[model samples]
Target chain A: MIKIDQLSKVFQTSNQSIQAVDHIDLQINKGEIFGMIGYSGAGKSTFIRLINRLEEPSAGSVLIDDQDITKLSKRDLRISRQEIGMIFQHFNLLWSRTVRENIAFPLEIAGLSKTERSERVDQLIQLVGLTGREDAYPAQLSGGQKQRVGIARALANNPKVLLCDEATSALDPETTDSILSLLVDINEKLGLTIILITHEMHVIQKICHNVAVMEDGRIVEQGSVLDVFSHPKQPVTKKFVEQVMGKPDNEVADDIFIQQVNSGKVLKLQFIGESTNQAFISQVAKKYDVELNILQGNIKQTQAGAYGSLYIQVTGTDEVVSQAIAYMDSTSIEVEVVAND
Target chain B: MTDLFPNVDWPDLMIATGETFYMTIVALIGALILGLLLGLLLYLTSPGGLWQNKYIHIITATFVNVFRAIPFAILIFLLFPVTIFLFGTFRGTTPAIPALIVGTAPFYGRLVEIALREIDKGVVEAAQAMGAKTSTIIFKVLLKESIPALVSGLTVTSIALVGYTAIAGMIGAGGLGDYAYFYGFTRRNFDIVFVCTVLIVIIVFIFQFIGDWMTKRLDKR
Candidate 1:
């Protein structure tokens, strides 16, 4: 478990001090994929680095599994460093060494014997699905292959906590999906707690159990994937969700719904969590004797469950319309009245 | 065929060749070691470098600039007293060691600085993220990864050292340059000067060739 308490980082430039990470506190549980999503320069990277002591926090303590690593000596810190592995967007593999040797670098530094180091290197090379490329150099490999080497190298010592610094940012979309799946596989098989930092919400929605949205060095919102996706409180979080789910324009949706429901009352519905079941949408319409016309609708599945948003027109009398919306509210679905056309 | 070269002694030519080889080899090794360490220091202590001492950088930079600006020939004459005191005479290859090392150390120091600067900063940050201490990052990552570039830089600087050795030879240090200056310049032995010039060219080409091969071999990344 990683706990950050009132952490802040201020870098003093020649002219003025810049607050890279403002006062923030967070707790990341063990064996879970925790994501920090934000735009560029939102202090997500700084927060992650603070957990690993890569960037010293100007204030507060970083407690990893009960040890306050912030105050440790440099020597002791190095020993602690062996436990937390990190991968980067650029891969950053040593160009001078072969993939095998690159993976074995940290193990060698930790004083593993040559035979032990080679065995560990081979194991990681297999784990990352680069078993045949161990002898190749970073220069000889493609971008995805190099990042695989980086992942393999980071896992050389079998760290419990893996920090991914925009690990998929440099890969193509197809490659990004493959890598994300690999990370998910590793997280499940080894129960390694992953702290993922990225600006892409799809990355979070795909694998993250919990996510935090950050802006200007502060976390604006955080919760389970379902909570943030179903009800985004912050504009930044809303924008991020729309980027992934492609929210239809409010004006267009309203006009189209008005046209469809010109004869009867209509309502906009938001289905979250367990309410994503088809039974709720279909059963409600059949029971009320109302024809359902979906104007704009989208459903996204997350770690928690499926969440959906839809504006549906229903040909029902005023009393039936009120009853239909009232019945839907008892479930996890939220029903709101659209203006009569 | 022997008329223009009748005064040439084959044994003396062989001895002069050996002298030039010794002078250039010894000075090149010393200069490389000195310059590489100095360069590492300059890199590690620059702004945002590992240690990050602006004062140390200024002082070191001033010393390097001072030495680098000095003409090698004039510096050799100026060091005559110390050369004599150190070697018991201001003549021969032994006296030339001080001048040669002094002249080449700063030159190679500056070269090593440039080579080290050319390395990507991302590599350094990656090492740091892994919890590598400063020393490990330098010797293990920076120096090891940059070996190919460093080797090439050394090759260029060492070839320049060969030229320095000739200047040392001009100052009574027995080598190809001494033979050329004495037997060819004073005695007007055009054949001896031509042979010495050819030897210098061949030695430089050989060093340059080895340097290039080593660089290529190590540049597999």
Candidate 2:
């Protein structure tokens, strides 16, 4: 487990001091994937660097597995760092070394024997799915392959905590998906605690179990992936949710409701978990004798469960539409009237 | 022209060539070791460097600049006393070495600094995150990544040294240049001057060829 208490970082310039990270507290459990989402310069990168002591905190303590790492000596910090692996956005690899040598570097620092280093490097190469490219240099590899080498190198010492600084932002969307799945695979196989910082909502939606949305050096909102996606509380979180949702709430043209319904209504229906799979729309229509038109629908599977949202227009007798709305309210699905005039 | 080239001193030419090789080799080894060390110091002491020290950076930079600003011909004259103190002579192949080194080391030091500075900052950060000690970062990351640049810098230094070595012959250092001055130009032996110029050019070309080949072989990027 990693515990960050009131962690803050300040950069002192010639003219003035800038607070890159304000007072923030966070707790990440072992074997869980946590993500921090923010725009550029939101200080998410600084927050993550503080965990490994890459950037010294201006205030507060970082306790990993009950040890306050902020107070460790320089020598002790080096040893502690071996347990915390980090990957970067641009894939900061040694351009001169081959992939195998790059992965073997940390092991060499640990003073492992030649045979042991080679054996461990071989294992990591296989683990990251770069078995045959061990002898190739980073320059020869594609962006995705370079990141795989970076992942392999970071995991060389079997670290417990993996920090990814926009790890997939450099790759294409298809490559991003492949890397995300690989991250999930490693998280499950090794039970490694992953803390990734990204600006992309799809990245958080794809693999993160929990997410903290940051704005201007502060976390605006944080919760489980499914909870946040289904019911975003803050405006910033809502904006991010809209990024993956593909359209804002106001963008739902009123014509769809006006033209399809005369003296009818438009309502948003939210489904989570097993509710998403059930034919609730047909059931509600048949039971209440209402004609339903789904204007837009989106369903996605999160780490916790399935979350789906649909915008619909219902046209029928007033009594039947009211009965259908009342029936939806009484069930597991959440329904809200968008425009009820 | 026929009268000027009545008899060429082949044996004397060979000895002068040998003496030139001797002086260049000795000076090059000394300059390489000292210059590389000074360059590394300059790099580490600069602002935001790994071991930044304002005083060290200012002092080293001033010293390198002051020495580098002096022309080689005048520098040889200026270091006459120091040369005699170190080697007990200031008028032979042995003494010319000190002059050559003094001229070449600081010039090459800047080259080394430039080569090291060109390395990506991200590469160093990655090494640090991996728990590499400072010494390890220098040896395994900085130096390793900049090998091609460093080798090319050495090539430039060596070619420059060839020119400086010729100039060292002014103070009775018996090399090809001295032979050209005393026997070729002063004695009006145009053939000797032509032959010495050809040899120097060939030597410079050899260094360049080897440097280019090694750089290409070492660079994986």
In order, what lDDT does every prediction score? 0.85, 0.88
Deviation in Å, model 1, residue B176 alpha carbon: 1.5
* CA displacement after TM-score superposition, residue A82 of candidate 1 (Å): 1.1
Clashing residue pairs for model 2: none
- Residue B14 of candidate 2: its Cα lDDT? 87
Q: lDDT score, residue B142, model 2?
A: 87
Chain A only: TM-score per candidate: 0.86, 0.88
Model 2 residue B167 distance off true place after TM-score fit, in angstroms: 0.6
**What i-RMS does each candidate reach, in Å?**
1.4, 0.7
* Model 1 pairs whose backbones collide: none
Off by over 4 Å in 2: A250-258, A261-267, A273-294, A312-331, A336-341, B1-7
Q: Model 1: residues >4 Å from true position, as ranges?
A: A248-252, A255-271, A274-296, A310-341, B1-7
Complex DockQ, candidate 2 = 0.72
